[model samples]
Target: MRGGVNMSGWAGFSDEELRRMQRKGAEQRPAESGSCPAPGPRKAASSAPRSRQQLQRERALQQAAQRSRAAGEEALQAGQQLSEPPPERTSPGAPEQTAGPGAPSPRPEVKQSPAAESEESREEAPEVKELDRQEAEEVLRTRLQVLQQQQSLMEEQNRVKKDLLTRTLQLKSQQTQAEAAMLKTVRAELQQLETMATNDISILRGRIEEADWEYSKARKRYERAEAEFVSSKLDLHRKAELKEHLAEHLYAIIQQKELRKARKLEELMLRLALREEEREAGPAVETQLEAENVETVKEADFEKEAGTEEGAGSKKEAESPEL
Candidate 1:
């Protein structure tokens, strides 16, 4: 089992998948064993075109290497424990093994001393620790690169959002201005119509009064005369003409007023819709990121405080004398 791979979790996997995973795990063994030379610097994911799966595989490789290293350490420890001398099983009164009369004395014991074995283990520890450190650094580097890329993307998105917001605001302002202008125009037309209506009413009132006077005079003249006079007929015709003119003018003014009011309302509604849309679509991506950044800074400050406390505890322990 020492050199064998654990393919225990291959329940739903095909042979091809199993073989590939095994092959990849094996490829990472040399790095894990600390027999291979140090890995050179690697490219960050941001700088080069790397598939997502490839980066995932690299992370998997590092994890597998770490597991292999841990397993190797466990095996080494087991071997050390096994190497320890077993307890003797002699009876309390039993004698030590005596060399036979003709048997030559056993060669002097030349087994490795405990101190030498410990020293060897100590020497091996650093080598394993160094490999673990390297693997950790590599993993952190990849993660840092991913974070940097994510930050850049977020910044770009924020910039785009800002530009869009600016455009919307400009458009809203333009729409507002247009609506105001149209309102002003409509207001002016309404004022003009009102003035015209006033003038027409005054003119119609004067004409009606004049016609009434004329009709009265015509009736008087007609009454005074034995027969209806021609002059009386002319006054009646003039009165009828004024009434027709007043009615036509009033109808035209009413139509114009209705049309202008409808147009103004439509424009007002359009402007309101635009404003509502702009309001609903939030325009504060940068602000939100800023808040997130503030939270991150606060978290970092807390982490630093914890780290300082840990260091202070370690220092206190170092200063204190052992009992």
Candidate 2:
């Protein structure tokens, strides 16, 4: 989703259309929470990623906030004073709540466990502090997710900024070309001034002064344009260089991650295949091992028989000689 560009839609979009898309993305962005909440959530949305990661994070944060609020209320009911941070922004135009006698009483903080009287209240916290603790953990985890979203969003903004810089450079180049044309016009005017040099001396003097003034203005304009063009060109070069580096690094990282994934998948498949083979061959392997053991036993028995027969025959031959 980080790279899900609508290339077709992009080609068709005018500057105004592109801007509208960017704004629409920003407006549709869910409210941010405890973290930096810096910027570019809207731009991130323009990617139109189906991940729903941001949406899920926002929802988790809302739930955590709700739990925090409930805990505060319960603590308040238990005669424990609690301070609360400002609530995170939600969608616009939330209905207002007015205070009146008709308003419902705050719900009592119900505790599943019995409360110890004076000692627990002395600390100025209710048993629901555990609930608050759990909610804090949830908030921390949500913060991690928000940080990731911000990272991706930051990357997207960088790309957008790069495009803007490229456009600005192009415009600047065009402006410089226009300035060159102006310089040509000024040269033509100087030729006119030279032609007038032979006319009435007083008239020529006036024209000379006019030409000098025009030349000065043109010179200043040219200098300014040249300086601006050089600076912009340098800045554009730096941005492009940095962009290429980032692209290369990101590409390498993606390749590495993909390779790792492929390896893992391969390993898992191999394990599965091996498991199937083992299951199929298990009995046969066991039978072969058993047969080897049986053969060894038989060979041992035959050696024992041969040794006994030779000993008995040698004793009988000795007895026959004695006879």
Best by TM-score: 1
Q: lDDT per residue, candidate 2, 213-260, as tens digits?
A: 999999999999998888778666665666576567657766765676
TM-scores for every candidate against the unseen true structure: 0.31, 0.25
Lowest lDDT block of 10, candidate 1: 83-92
Clashes of 2: 1
Tell me the deviation in Å of residue 140 in model 2: 2.5
The C-alpha stretches of model 2 lying farther than 4 A from their native spots are 1-137, 192-323
> After superposition on all CA atoms, what RMSD does each candidate show versus the true structure?
60.3, 65.7
lDDT to native, each model: 0.50, 0.51
Candidate 1: count the clashes: 0
